[model samples]
Target chain A: MDEEAAKKLIVETLQKKKGKSKFYLKDFYKMLPDEKPRTVKNLVNKMVGEETLEYWSSGSTTLIGLKGVGKQAGAEDEED
Target chain B: MVEFRHKTPLIDQLETGPWTSFVSDIKREHESRMENPKGIDFQFNQDCCDDLLGVLELSYEHGRTHWKHGGIVGVFGYGGGVIGRYCDQPEMFPGVAHFHTMRVNQPMGHFYSTKYLEQIMDLWERRGSGLTNMHGATGDIIFLGTSTPQLEEVFYELTHNIKQDLGGSGSNLRTPSDCMGQSMCEFACYDTQEICYQLTMEYQDELHRPAFPYKFKFKFDGCPNCCVASIARSDISFIGTWRDDIRIDQEAVKAYVGGELKPNAGAHAGRDWGPFDIQKEVIGLCPTQCMSWDGSKLEINTPECTRCMHCINVMPRALRIGLDTGCSLLLGAKSPILDGAQMATLVVPFIKVEPPYDEIKETVIEPIWDWWMEEGKNRERLGELIKRQGMQKVLEVTGFKAIPQMIQEPRSNPYVFWKEDEVPGGFKRDINEFRKYHQR
Candidate 1:
């Protein structure tokens, strides 16, 4: 799939999946099975760069979330 | 501004001894801060030192620690570099209730100038408990205690004024450290500081954010001497080494025999260990039994030599490490927590350590991370994961060959686990054939 279609699909998936804002980069790869993993990774990182999505990290693991959706820095999350 | 005058009769007893007390240091900081007081803004009304002392006294009284792990607290846009801590009895000691630790990434070899150190101390004094760990085991400049609110401010000051970044904490890529290789030591095979700095800069994102299942550390040692103790401490250890024969000076060896030069570069100068015996001390002590001395000179069996540095250490002037130098990449070393302490198992026998370190990153580091991230459980260390899965898995993932250097000796146990592919008929062999032969 193209970048635009993949991006739309990811947003839709994230939107539909209620009560869960954060996801692993692997989750995105699973979401777009048709696209190459490298392509999907690049596009996801591109979204992060554009602030369409932000990274939620627990120091041991990193998860991707829609911008302004999950806990930002210093947001009182429990230890992983 | 209020003076912290909490009575601590139990804690005070420790001050009478000759050894300098930590309580005294804290008290001094408290006194200094009180004299030049700033408006305390956090919910904890008293200064950090006051509350910290209060909590310690309470702990002494109850014989139990009151401190508990706090929620995730860190600088903006970063996941790690800050460890959150809280006191259970917040009402009794408000200052230390939200006490946190900020780990600042120290220089490569911890070669800090006075000005840089002063800048860090100044920032910590203004914002923290003034308790500093000169360097943590991971080699970060640890800012011991501060409030949750002050974390960002301290980070701002660190970045803006000191121009330094936070080190890794939690499960991220920890601050890479190295021995004083070319800076101080002559036995250094590679530039440890340069490689450490390069990897630190190259993997900045990995350091600041959580990217793996658990914490990963990179420690560089200049040579087999392992001054940094990376073999048992770090997740990935780069130990410098050489492939060529040891360089020997026959004249210098003769000088030591004549008592013209001191053995071990005068390291044992204070001790009267009698005259130096070249045969008994140097050649006799060689682990590989590779060295032999005739009447005229010493000869070494280079192929049999394991490069343990025993001979060279004893006679520094007479011998030197070979010129063809590189490093051995060992993996999965950690302190005993679950499966017990593990010295890093040799993964790469030798790799030329150079700028960018692309060979190591591409061939070893990235592959292992990719595998571990997929297979590793949460809170599990890399060594633990490697232990759970056999070393063969590691070799398969990294495309490393099975070399004799990977193991100390051949396995004594006869119960070998052979793969189905390795068997002649594979695992699907008919059970009827076995019954026919056995006549069950």
Candidate 2:
């Protein structure tokens, strides 16, 4: 898949998850079988740079979530 | 009854302007004695005359309060206390001007037994100024105003009891200081007391001898809580740190959040809890920024943490440090030694050598001596040397490999590699996972 198709898939996946805070970039790669790890990383960086996603890491696992998705997903709703 | 005579010319010259007002008050008090029949012992001793000349000579060049050039004069007080002064007028303080300077013998932690303290105090009363500065700026006890003739005799008596010479001053390895380590503090990752003692014992020859390009100071702290502020102060700083992840106590953390106990509040309170859930609270509370969680189990970010024991201090039951962990060596962190004061640079990434720190001695200490001996200028510190030599030369001499973690950010260096296999150890998945993939 090309960059455009990859971007389309990410946007669709994000829309499908709706108010979900986190999603695996690897799952997006699985959807785009021919795309490389570098391509997926670059796309994720672009999305995060655009402030659409927030990326945090633990050990060797990167957790990518929507920037304000936590607000929408009610993760911090109890505290607020 | 004895008559007292004041040297009118000297007093007039010395007591000019505002000083004359104070002199008038003193004259009024001594007026009755001045009229008495017999002559008081007002003759100056030859030694005092010589000291007076020396004081006059120094004062002529540098105004009295110039401590760098002015010599210290101490007067003995009645109750074993000595009044010390870096004076412009040594003649004014007569008894103290005649007293010899005494050097206080300080241990690694500046610790002394009750007997030792009393013995030193007694010696101060007998041979030198009856006062003691627990430790001077160079970290030695300074008993000011001793005669050159009495110096040897005083030293002989002091050492005969303590069996150690006065510590180095004026271009030598000054006394080493260590923070209260295992004896008192909880944050000590390494035995600071032992390291101080070990360095003192191991370098006793160097400590007493003025051999270095300039004075060198070594200070140790058990952890980055830095009770001694060694990193910013010493020529060489040994700060206790660990390579392992900080241990966490989820249960105690739960209790703290549930209000079962108050968190440690005073000096050692590690980190601030900023309104996060108890289970996820560990991440924010660690000094190293090492603690983290993924809605399951808590994890520690070892590389980022300085092992300040903040998390451990906070959740004592949950967080405990690992064993046999050595310290990280930070170089050139002198507080304005040369260039504007700089925090010590992390020199040796991290090494695992403990109390009998022979490996550290060989790797860290020996290299420092060789570097300073060969290249350092007068009064220049190790950090200044590194600043002069540049980090590349320092790494070249010390044999430390350049890594991404070496500099906070990637600089234009051909040696640093970003590829997986190019890294010293094969880059693990965790390295990739935490890449801050969101960088702009």
TM-score of each: 0.83, 0.60
Q: Choose the strongest candidate by DockQ.
A: 1
Q: List the residue pairs that clash in candidate 1.
A: none
DockQ result, candidate 2: 0.01
For candidate 1, report its TM-score.
0.83
List ranges where model 2 is wrong by over 4 Å. Answer: A1-80, B1-88, B96-102, B265-282, B285-290, B293-298, B303-308, B412-440
Candidate 1 residues lying further than 4 Å off, grouped into runs, are A1-80, B1-4, B12-20, B37-46, B413-440
* Weakest lDDT window of 10 consecutive positions for candidate 2 chain B: B72-81
Question: What are the iRMS values of all candidates?
Answer: 4.8, 29.3
Mind giving the per-residue lDDT tens digits that candidate 1 earns over B25-124?
8888777666655543333233678778888998999999987643446666676788776678877776776778788999888898999988887778
Against the true structure, whose TM-score is highest?
1
Q: Report the TM-score of candidate 2, chain B only.
A: 0.69
The prediction achieving the highest lDDT against the true structure is 1
Worst 10 residues of 1 chain B by lDDT: B37-46
Among incorrect, acceptable, medium and high, the docking class of model 2 is incorrect
| Residues B81-135, model 2: lDDT tens digits | 1212233343453433444334454776677789877777566544543444566
